[model samples]
Target: MAQQVQSAIPARSGGNHPKGLPYLFLTEMWERFGYYLMLGIFVLYMKETQGEGGMGFPAVTAYDIFGTFIAFTYLTPFLGGFLADRKLGYINSVYLGGALMGLGYMGLALPGLGFFYASIALIIIGNGFFKPSISTLLGNLYSEEQYKDKKDAGYNIFYMGINIGAFVCNIIGAFMRNKFDWSAAFLSAGVGMFLGLIVFTIGLKHYRHANVLKPAVAGDTGIGQVLSLVFLPAIIAGVLGWMIPGDILGSDSTDAFIAATIPVIIFFVSLYYRANKDDKRPIAALLAIFAVSVMFWAVFKQNGTVLTDWAQNYTDRQVSESMEQAAGKLYLAEEVSSKESMVTQYDNQFRTLKDDNGKEVKAMGRSVYFRNIDPARIPADGKPVYLVNTELFQSVNPGWVVMLTPLVVAFFAFLRRKKKEPSTPAKIAWGMLISALSTLVMVAAVYAGHNGEFKVSALWLVGCYGVITIGELFLSPMGLSLVSKLSPPRLTALMMGGFFLSTSIGNKLSGILAKTWYNYEDKSHFFLVNCGLLLVSAAIGFVMLKWLNKIMQEKGVK
Candidate 1:
């Protein structure tokens, strides 16, 4: 591999940064466009009735699959980073990963059970390579002193592009899924991913300088040793977990997931143990941040799972008739029959109550949960309400991101000018606190709706997304910046992988939490629990502020 590939070569420079940055920016935008486009509809497709061109899985089951896929998708960056650091280099890794992911998205369009699972596996493996390599490449671009000070701003700009793709994808996904078929939407995602690959290929020359292969550090584990110690054992253990006679985690798939995570966890733990003295404190700090951040992700990711269920089944989605003609012409909205009797299906899906023997006893009249909604609030009979599709709700957070990025950037820029800015850790701490408050909107919605007895205004969802997007603007990009700033030069890419590893674990936890969605008797309590979890995480982040700021000062970042 080394002989086949050359070291990273520098790209041409312009005013303040490399000319390649724009190309890289566009590439990431399209890549996220594809990924989020598919993800926005993944769970909805799984849980929708078969008549609607979906798999019609149970809600909890769909949440589990959603969580697992997202978890493993983040996990692979570790392997990708390790290989890129040692052998393959960043550019090749990105190409290989993008191709696999594109193929995976295409495979999902195939109408066969065999292709379905296989497609998920391909996406998981492919994401491992693609995710970390690109971030590492971006970090390399800013390594020069001239660009170093602007690194956070550049990442914020890049992050905005990511959200732009995310914001627009839901409209495309909704249009494709509603107007054509689920398969068409899936295929569109594949096409978008492939387009990103094409853009990356065209821009390759601009980023070649950042793809250098580093010599292994002293005491660095050999490739052969890592394979034996990590990959081989992990596979064996996972298979064993799957094949074991007794159920350990309710399903073989769950057992396998838990088992598979073991070796990966061990490897990260070993990173701390093996660190040099200078690197130890920083590594410890990163690990601490990673662990605390999981709760935030667990709650935040529910936008696609439990929250999606609420939007589809409980929220008022009736469109106004005055705009129906134009909406229909543009193929931007869906028209479900409001007069259609949804009682039987809704009860069947939600499972309202239990009998004396603990068997499910389904109820009548739209599960009583939606019984209090005024008929006037629903669409007029036989007239199609050209309402925005449910999947479009996924765009809310990203939409807020696009609207708020400039303000957030300006806010921090103001702080920088006055030298009154909080450290990145402090920003992250405030983010969690603010994010926790966002859940209160949902809690209030629960009260307003009388525990789902009535339909809450869709504006509640909009308000919640707006509040949390501010917190996300504060935290998510800063986490990436923190990883880059605090990491040792050789460990930069590896620490990037570490950040994803944290995300992977948090995704799995999100799944676990969502699976229990049906068990919440009063849903307000559930959201409150979510709020409390974020508050605890925020508390932890604040408690460590002094130490984290000291480290930032030592590293000259704050």
Candidate 2:
């Protein structure tokens, strides 16, 4: 492979930034639009009865699948980044990955179990190729003399675009599903991905300079060697775990995933051992961050599962006429306007109704929140009311992210001016602590709700998201920037993949933790688990702060 596929980026005097930012920004926006749109409704779709064109899986089964799917989606980035660095140039990889993802989303519109599974596989594989490479390429733009100082800001802006896509997609997802069907909602996701591809292609020339492919050096491990050591062993381990008679972990799939991951973990450890003296400390620092971050992601990533459940059944969603009217304009309202009180049936929701002979019928109601509404606030027998769509709750974090990105960027900039800006390590430590604090808000909400006997105000969720968003602002962009600033040029994309790997682990754990929501009689305990996770992570982060910062300084990375 050539060392660098450098294109002459168009020069703009005093601009000091690449023209490609807008293109990348918009491309990522649409990509996230598709991804988040699909994710926002994924669990809901899984829970629907088979007669309703869903899997009709049990809650445990659904979460297990969810965990596996998300885990595999991120796992491929390591391999994808490796290939992009060694063989396929970044541009080719991006196009191929985007097309695969688009096709995967569209495939969901088709019927049958095979197609569904195949579509998911396509998406997971495609994401591996798409995610890390693009971020690595974006970081490449900052390698320019004039743009280096602006890298963090650029990443923050890029992150904001991601949230913009996430925020808007839930609106679209909620409207599309409510207006049409699951097929229509999924088709919309496919269309969004294709649009992202078009945007990426349109800006090909601008990103071309950043598509450098690094060739293997004399001492580097070859693809064949890596496959033999990592993939081969992992596959055998997973199969053995799956075939085992009893549960070694939660389930067969979880057992297999855990087994499969062991070799990969070993591979990372080996990387540290093999890395030269110059690269070892930085790699070690990143690995530490990666490990601690698993806790944060485990808690933060529950938005789709546990948090969705809270919004759907526990929270007060009833909105006033004016609020409903405005939200409807944004495609954010669910029509709970029917006056009839005939109860419906669904899994994971509850209502007590009388059967013909005075026997209790454990029915599921349309507005299950009705069960938790204050007796006085409950609509008289058949009165109509409005509620925001449950999926709209998924947008709260991303919305907060978009709103606060600028302020966060400016805050760090302010600190920089005063020569008091916290180092990246310090920022990450604080991020974890703040993340721990966010869970307390949910604990308060649980108490206020009387353990789902009454509805808690939406403000609790908003507040939690606000606090977590601050944590996200501190750690996420900084983590991305740190990888770029410190990684060996040849291994930059690989390290980016590493960060995603950590997040992947956390995401899977999030699913696992969410799986236990049904088991928690005291809802506050659920939030407490999340709080404890972040607290432990924060403690570890604080303990290593001095060491991590020293490494950054030694490596000449801020």
Tens-place lDDT per residue, model 1, 1-558, is 111111111111112455566666666777888888889999978876565567767667788899888988987787888887778898888888888988888788887679889999999998888888888888888887887866776677668778887888889888887778888888888888888788788878888988888787887777787789988887888898889888687666667777987997788778889988888788878877877778888888888887887787668765566777877877778764544444333452363343577443433333233345686655455444555678889899889988788778777777878888788889999999999998999999989888887777899999999999888878888888888888777777778788888888888778888877777878898899889999999999999999999988887886
TM-score, every prediction: 0.91, 0.92
Candidate 2 clash pair list:
7-209
| Candidate 1 stretches greater than 4 Å from native | 1-17, 244-251, 340-344, 348-372, 378-381
lDDT of all predictions: 0.79, 0.82
Error of 1 at 38 (Å): 0.8
- Give the Å error, residue 457, model 1: 1.6
Per-candidate clashes come to 3, 1
- Residue-wise C-alpha lDDT for candidate 2, range 1-558, written one tens digit per residue: 001101211121112457777788778989999999988888878866565577666666777788788888887888788888888877888888899999999898888889989999999989999998889999999999888867877788778878988999988888888777889999999999999988888888888999998877766778888789887998899899899999778789888888888888888777789998898999999899999988888888888888887887888888876786676666667666344444444333442233587333434344555666776665666566768888888899999998888788778777877888898888988999999899999999989978887878888888988999999988888888888888888888888888888888888898889888878889889899899889989999999999998998897667
Residue 496 lDDT, candidate 2, scale 0-100: 82
